[model samples]
Target: MLLPARTLRFCVATAAAAIAVTVGLTGCGSDDDSGSATGTTATASTTTAASATTGSGQAAGATPSVEELQTTLAILSDPAKTTQDKVAIVVDGEKRATNIESMTKALAGYGTLKFVVSDVKVTGDTATAQVVISSPNGDAPPMPLTWQQVGGKWKLSDASTCVLLGFAQAPCTP
Candidate 1:
């Protein structure tokens, strides 16, 4: 079946929101590679900071919880949120503004679709989240989503959006 823009955007938005949660949970710093004993202390502080943000027992730099991710998706899907708000969660916000209306309309058709996070792998400022989408037709195979941490928020990478929109892997501006 053809993937409608709204449906694809829903997946992308969900993944992006989840990644953003990861950023908030993990903080904007990477683990120190120093073997010095003092570095261990620093690690503890990082973990404490992460725990404060997530309120879970998650260690510093750990992935976000599945529930947090799902919550983000739910918020984004709310019709009460403005188009500007929804677009802000997208990878290329300004570029996507023009198409938000059409995409929102398309979203109305696929109410049965569900997104399940399979795994999330983070490396530096980039992350790959695997998601399984299920609908009336059946469960779609797992799809790996690419996300980038930008200005302390997680957003979809241009490449991921391009692929989701059925474009070739080229240098996409949006």
Candidate 2:
């Protein structure tokens, strides 16, 4: 599961590899906001979704509804979504078109992943989502994902997206 040390930077090689494998291993799970899948429902409590406040240059957006985060995250983890579809969903995804394609290919046949959003916090326009990847296979420990408010919508952050791309051996730098 270990990749060459030189292949790692912001995402350690082993962790990156585990992510790719984790995506493939999960069955189906459901979050209160996201759609239903076949895996075990998360044990964590889902807070009531808050109305979103648009984030600007240095202002932080309010805690988004679980619906918003689930909606955006569903697209990010769905391998079947097109590159263009993904491009529009991630922060700075416009420029990471090629990198996105690489990840899509790497994750192809893994099917859609399910998740539970355990927590969310926004600092300025950037935010972090604590989530657990779920599947019929099992549930991963909670992991933090980055996000950003672009224009007015929440998009997965470029750094996190690139880490995903890295698992596919795509040459991307966050």
Candidate 3:
């Protein structure tokens, strides 16, 4: 299976709502005699942002600082936000909001989430950066991320949306 059922159950709590980087799994291959899933891939029908005004849609009004983006993500990643507020800091947040419940669950077992960003670059309404997500459990490998200036704030680029949502890697290309 591409994504284990247990992993999906754990991370799909808020889906893209939190932009937590939990890749979606479209299907899980049946287990062989040994009893193990086969592969993981994520696909979703809801692609476009519903209105683009979800918490993720709000713009920064200026070029976003790496620290600012990290702080916002930390707040959005909080599992408590599910009941307190549904302000998801992600790209096309309205579309991602559809899976808020799953995203929330993904954060339940994690410790405090931390992000380190470098090589901030901005050009017009687009930007790119090196990012790493870390926690007590483990640290995600650093990767380059593309961001878009939406409604004056920096949001994950569509390419990022494609990757996070379990779509093609080529979609990440400019």
Candidate 4:
């Protein structure tokens, strides 16, 4: 069945949000060692900051154009920025993965990531964007990405998805 563009977008967004929540609640680590544990916090912080900045909208005292968001997505999708790690913040807990380099390697053959912004809701320095990512293999489900403004810069607050395996978390409760 052919789904409406809006419906398709929503589906993708929902999937992304679900993944984000899952990864956020899960702990990050490999069975091998704990030396890399410290990397989790650092990576999470960086990812959160970058996501918030990229997805963020206008500041409480200023107005940022939509172009800013577009630019943010572009930068986030870049392979270079993908090294920022993957983290999720859930209602009950937080999940983080510091092995971003590994994740990138795994996704290397997955093809480029193309994000489509279906809709955006902005309030002050915070905003929730409905986005869908398409890969060479296929299109991923839609996901909700949260953003916040800090120091007049917008960054990702929570990707809601894209967490590493062990670092994945459960969904947040409504």
Candidate 5:
């Protein structure tokens, strides 16, 4: 239940794509549910840009700021954390709490999920980052992942989570 039914070819979705439309979900390559971003645009105030820095004293394209690294750490947290807390670090978290839980458990035995973030772009509340993810299984190719600012805090976008869940070939369709 780590990845969605689609080979995780579904794994490399862009948050830019999710921000531009309503994302849809499906079963992970197995039982855990994750999804894809498709269809129309959203109604929220939207802004898109590739920034060199988020102005928090950290350059977006250079060394990842403390905030950015923190986000990456949240994604790789100990599996013992509550699903609610885990979900809190990702966009649309409440809706995908179950899938998050399933994926968390599935990877618990594998050890931590590791990542490196670079080439980051910040647009208003949404940011796109080039990321290389590694799990106990191995390292996945470098990819673009979207991040969102919700309630004044940054969280991994749902679309990005969908792709990440595939880190170990687990089915995460939502």
Candidate 6:
């Protein structure tokens, strides 16, 4: 039996959204050699400071408004925006490497993904947001994310337990 077009679209959108969340949470690694290079402490410190300051600056530039972040989340959550043509810019501009592949897999019936933002904290131009994501069968634990404001916009910066889950090996940088 053929499902309604709307139903098919809903399934696709839900799958895509799930992939975006998973990839956004666990992708990318900084190329800095601080951990391996001896006597690179100074460089590591500088890098950390720079990243922190950039986040702070971005959070500060928005007139203390959560509107931008909220709007971004809303747009991303929309099913209609799941198309590659529509989401390519967001994925590429944000440097979300894992999202595309994960999204494709999710669309192919891997599972469902859903999320909700519970809180947000902004200091200067940097902000941290807390979000919880759930899986399709409702068997997996909810993934918690710590999002950071960068370049005047919020992006997923860290996941508390992604490595443990084996979804990704590296943490997001920037």
lDDT of 3 by residue, 1-174 (tens): 123667644443333223333322212222343532222111111111122233665543335677655544455456656523433455666555544445455544344556676666655566666666554434455555567776566666655444443311112223
RMSD of each: 18.0, 8.1, 14.4, 11.7, 12.8, 18.5
Off by over 4 Å in 2: 1-17, 23-60, 135-137, 168-171
- The candidate, 1 or 5, that scores higher on TM-score is 5
lDDT of 6 by residue, 1-174 (tens): 233778745644454455456555432434443442111000000011222334444423333234444344434333334444323324233344354334333333222334444445444544444344443333223233333444455543433222212342233344
lDDT per residue as tens, model 4, 54-92: 345533534334455544554433444544422322111
Q: Supply the global lDDT for candidate 4.
A: 0.43
Residues 1-174, candidate 5: write the lDDT tens digits.
Answer: 133546445435442233112112111223433432111111112223444655574444332243454454455344666787777787877777767777666555334445566656565666676665544334456566677766556678787776655542334663
Query: What lDDT tens digits, residue by residue, belong to model 1 across residues 50-106?
Result: 223334433434454444343334333434456787566667766755454444443
Q: What's the true lDDT of residue 126 in model 2?
A: 66
Candidate no. 2 TM-score: 0.66
* Tens digit per residue, CA lDDT, model 2, 41-150: 23333443344433443334555555677767677656767888888988878889988787666555544456677667766666676666664444455656677777
CA lDDT scores, all candidates in order: 0.46, 0.62, 0.47, 0.43, 0.52, 0.37
**Clashes per model (N, Cα, C within 3 A):** 0, 6, 21, 23, 22, 10
Per-model TM values vs. the true structure: 0.51, 0.66, 0.52, 0.47, 0.58, 0.38
Which candidate gets the maximum lDDT versus the true structure? 2
- The stretch of ten residues in a row with the least summed lDDT in candidate 2 is 36-45
Q: Give stretches of model 3 more than 4 Å off.
A: 1-62, 83-88, 161-174
